[model samples]
Target: MSANHRPREGRPAIFVTGAASGIGRACAELFARRGWFVGVYDVDTDGAQAIAATLGKDNAVAGAIDVSDADAWQRALAEFWVHSGERLDVLFNNAGILAPGSFEAVPLARHEAMLAVNVKGIINGCHCAFHYLQRSPGSRVINMASATAIYGQPELVTYSATKFAVRGFTEGLDLEWSKFGIRVSDIWPSFVKTRMAASFAQIASARALGIRLDPEDVAAAVWACAVAKPRFHKTHWTVGLQASLLAFATRIAPSALSRQVVRYLAR
Candidate 1:
């Protein structure tokens, strides 16, 4: 493996968005544990700094960034590059929100907020990180997509739509950035036991189905995607057994069958 593929002194670094709590926080901690300098960026500055503190002052840099704002993304990543010797090995667009309820029952503001943070967040992060990622050999982008990307859910319709947008962007960028030697990939994990998951009204189904995943599980997958070989670079990394099974089924199953399965799960 190239030195860039793993964390080394002042070289490999990862910046995680929404690093306050939940999956983003977990990703930042895992990368730090692996010896990578981590940037904890979030709208919640206190939460961001708390994560950085746990990682140790020398191991992490904390910044508050609202991912929907392109300018903020540029500024935060610029600082991150400076801290890591201008190197960026991975950019984890792990910040997102879940709004669960009937589409019309949810306020329009909530829908718009979801779009800004979940969809535009990925766009802003990838666009701003492009130059840094290009400079770092074997660099990768790991977007936090959900199983909802495979199909729409009534409760999380807006959130599902955002993930679909992320999945499309990951595929498009993977093709576009390959010439630049940057690997782009997305992850599809089922409901994880985070504050975000608990906020979902239909979260009980995951418990009923006995398929709730842990944040560390997805964190492990993020690390795997970060260092995966170019030849073995998977476009979509699915976490947990249910996600793995659904990924396989969706690829081979008919559209109608998958749609039916989605409806069943949302029940």
Candidate 2:
């Protein structure tokens, strides 16, 4: 049976960053499938437009924004809120970059860029969308954290640190916004089979780990976080077995032991 598609007039709405591809695109599609209006925001306007088209004209809107820029985030959210009748039920800060090489091997410029997008981007999204979220009952913010955030990974040093920043930001804001009735949370997914993962496929140890998740799996978790009653109190949403296990291990194991486990996985 075909999924139930809601009419556009009275549906809830979500704004997703990095909606050009990968998990962001998947989340946009899924939200549209479930009858929510979607704002597909990405630096790649063409890619965002394509996804919006796929969701059908009535279901989606597209915008181009460099998340690293706070002003751009303001412009994007303003446009999105207008399209969504000034109602924003969710803000999925899913846009990020990963440099899957050794810290020293990756250039300084790339590390700076990663921090700008992966860390600053999320903060921009949260700040820009807070007013809209405060006005909308049950609204929430969902950031894209990573398994690497649990403990830093060697090859993905900068990227790992950025995810840690995201995790910390999500937790802090989740509490701060409680009085405003706006919830916040993040997803930690390990090795999703997206273009980003493909970029690192040549790494023997990553391949040896032999566990990969579909973008849709992470998308489903995003949806879960959005609609879960008691909302964002559960700030850590893990997307796969490995992600969940590692999250558990990090809590119980010593820091050295956890680092060893990550080293073993890399090997």
Candidate 3:
């Protein structure tokens, strides 16, 4: 059953958190195309199931579970192991959301939910993945960071903070996970087209903060990192030309960059 698509030897199962949509969906699709056994986990059961169905029984397994839930992670992994019969070769921590508003305007519940789903979810995924990731040599984990991690976005201070946390955690894990032969990389994507952010105003506002990576483009980056030789890259590849420039300029001249951001975002 397993050899029909991917190689019969070595770990070929790839567990993708947030696999129902956006960058995660793309990564799942890429891995499935290569005959890899893909375990698609997401809160959206229908979305995950649709992707798995398209990939065929030999290549993909779909499960609906929120990455933020530790227990859910355990249950989903148990199911994937039973179904796929292999440890995850690659894990993409890609479930996240956009909280757009000023600090004062945003509710505490929204903020907490964002932190739980974005920051804590990655932490939980990493912890849940340890044993499985250790089972395979050269297994990889890709954390979804952002250009905002490089600097502050006035309108998105909280979101920026979470991404910075992801960047910090990924860098730290890259060193700690090396002994287990699991390569940890962060994908810093810019504004991507996804249902998660489906509003034109949202897109326009994001441009003001320097984000512009199409979902497919970021997905390609994830696949590239998975097959590449292991390396500790504290700063991974970023998409979106505008966002990349903003990130670079923010480092060279933060004050100047902030002013530009204000001007661009202001009507």
Candidate 4:
């Protein structure tokens, strides 16, 4: 790490993937303002650098990383460890992509891309950052999942599947990593007003529910997860009213009824 990148002693650190924009950027800003060192990593080098510059050198470090690439994840984490004083207080797996259209209309490659980033990316981050998190007391991993994970959505099949994977991974890991003092949690958010959401504005579900959440709304949930006291079973945090209602319905409603509700909204 460069002189400017050296960690500030006693400042908690967070490594946020996809920190160039959207929810990731919001989390970075919020964390930095709250006196945490931030690692801003994204595939967009310039954008990541811009965010770092905005946050100031002492407060943040920036790097380019394609979350789908395991080697890139390794390199980014290694560098982050240096700047964060070997601390990984929070690993925010917020980088993900989506393709909304008829399931068949979206190309297979795009679906695979979504899986690589949304699912594999979280796996890579959690697996690679294990030791750092183990060393830091009260470390937590936060994965960005979608409300679509509550039930499959028609136009968002692959993206929904990926979040379901994240949800499962977070649950399993939280149990497995408890011995290491690492808590794993995922955030479930309904559509947010971001460029990514804009791309799917025409989808029936988006048209019906509307994009009521903002990036900051989801970021606040992430912050909550970061500071929340550990619990035996609180592994999922829903970000919006829609997401909370959907999560509640899935728990109480019959499977057939839940399916019909999804169908009605997605129609």
Candidate 5:
């Protein structure tokens, strides 16, 4: 570690995975600006380092992590723990991948990769960060779930499934981890204008709904969750008008009706 990048003492810290780009980068930037120590970790080592550097040496540290790999999560968090004054205020499980195509058309490997990064990644993160979160007062885990989790999206079948897994995982941990004072929450954002979203921009759902939310928009929601009072009932945070609407519909509408609505949008 460079002299300038050495950890400062006594600051709330956030460990953000997938911090090389998109929502992760945006959240890291937001929290650092708000006087929080930030750990920017991504599989893209150089990109994560670049982001950490931009956040200023004293505000941030950078590391390489492939979130699906359990061992890697341990290593990254261990390094982050040292720079963060041995405290982890928040762990943002923001790393994920998507494969948008007909279920059969998308390659099995792509689907499996999506499951690894999007679903297993969160499991690895929350499990690994359990102790750090338990030790830190008011610590939270924020998982990146998608609006597709509201209902099964046609073209985004596997991706949608992974988010549903995220939703369940978040809810379960929120309940289970409360004993340790570690609140768990997840963000549900519709299509966002990121490189990942661009890959599926031409999909039917994207064409119907249009990508409105930006990375910064979701980052703002994460910030809200990080600072919000610990309410046991309030767990999932939705971003963008469309995501909010979908989340609302899922609550009031019958399953059949909700399915029709999603089918129409995904057609």
Candidate 6:
């Protein structure tokens, strides 16, 4: 959300990165309905504010932030606190990037950018939001993951690698942050409807390969994770049953699934 707007006063706060679109926007809207003051952060300040306004000024604040930049995270938090006069109770590390290209064909610049935004971005938000989250007795962190992280999609290997990193980062944190009384959950969404899939050609390609999740369903799970109590859940919230099935098969039959994924996606 844009920084110029005033945050609605007198409500508990939630800080969500990538609130400009898709699941982030959906989560922001839903969280507001749940009565939390939402601190919306997105690189697209205008887009973020637009969504925040829809949720009513009484429940949201929009701010510009490139979650990968440490200083940008700092500035967004400072702005959020100044506007709301409250520390964040829930933080969503949801900003990420996906650029489709073959393993060898993927551009280095986009690969780096995806890694920075998808993996490092989550890490940065966790770092910057630590103080605020710790202040709340019930604070929790929700990190976004992808079904691509479960196994390699040959054509989108670079994006998958970054998602793999997200899975690892979230898992590692769930272990490390448990003692601090913070819950960490990683959401592995298969194919959510969002602008990020522009490079994926068709949702059918994803469907034939496996499942595709809806943004609203995933957003609802994000809200559940925020309020639900669990020290750390290692299972990535595999949205769409096919996602969980593939995850299971990959675990029980790695060799066969690897060969099958290549053959299935080749269609």
lDDT of 6 by residue, 1-267 (tens): 344555555566788889989889888888888888898889998898888878776678888999889999999987887766566777888998887756567678988898899988988889988887787676778888888888877667777888888888888887788788777778887788787766566333464654366678888888767766564444368877767877888888867766687467656
Which of the predicted structures, 4 or 6, would earn the higher TM-score when compared with the native?
A: 4
**Residue 125, model 4: Cα distance from true site in angstroms:** 0.9
- The lDDT ranking, best first, is 4, 5, 2, 1, 6, 3
Per-residue lDDT of 116-167 in model 2, one digit per residue for the tens? Answer: 9999998888888878898899889999999889888778889899999999
Runs of candidate 4 with Cα error greater than 4 angstroms are 1-4, 231-233
Mind giving the per-residue lDDT tens digits that candidate 1 earns over 1-267? 001222246658988999989899998899888888998999998889888888887788888899999999988988888777778889999998877887899899999999999999999899888888988988899998998887777677898899999999999999999999999999999888898766655544454456578899999999888988788989998888887888789899999999888778767
- Residue range 1-267, candidate 5, lDDT tens digits: 322445778889999999999999999999999999999999999999999889898899898999999999998888888878899999999999988888899999999999999999999998899889888988899999989888889988899999999999999989988888888899999989887977776589899998898999999999999999775347989899999998999899999999999889877
- lDDT of each residue in 1-267, candidate 3, tens digit only: 121333345547788888888888888888887767888888988888888888787777788788889999888877777666666778888889877777788898888888998899999998987888887667888899887686666667788799999988998898888777777888777677787666335434565554356678987888777777655343376777766776677767868767776456643
What RMSD does each model have against the real structure? 4.2, 3.8, 3.3, 1.4, 1.4, 2.5
> Residue 107 of candidate 6: its Cα lDDT?
77
Query: How do all models score by TM-score?
Result: 0.93, 0.94, 0.87, 0.97, 0.96, 0.90
Runs in model 1 lying further than 4 Å from the true structure: 1-9, 203-211
Go through the candidates in order and give the clash count of each.
0, 0, 2, 0, 0, 2
Write the number of the candidate with greater lDDT, choosing between 2 and 4: 4
Ranking by TM-score: 4, 5, 2, 1, 6, 3
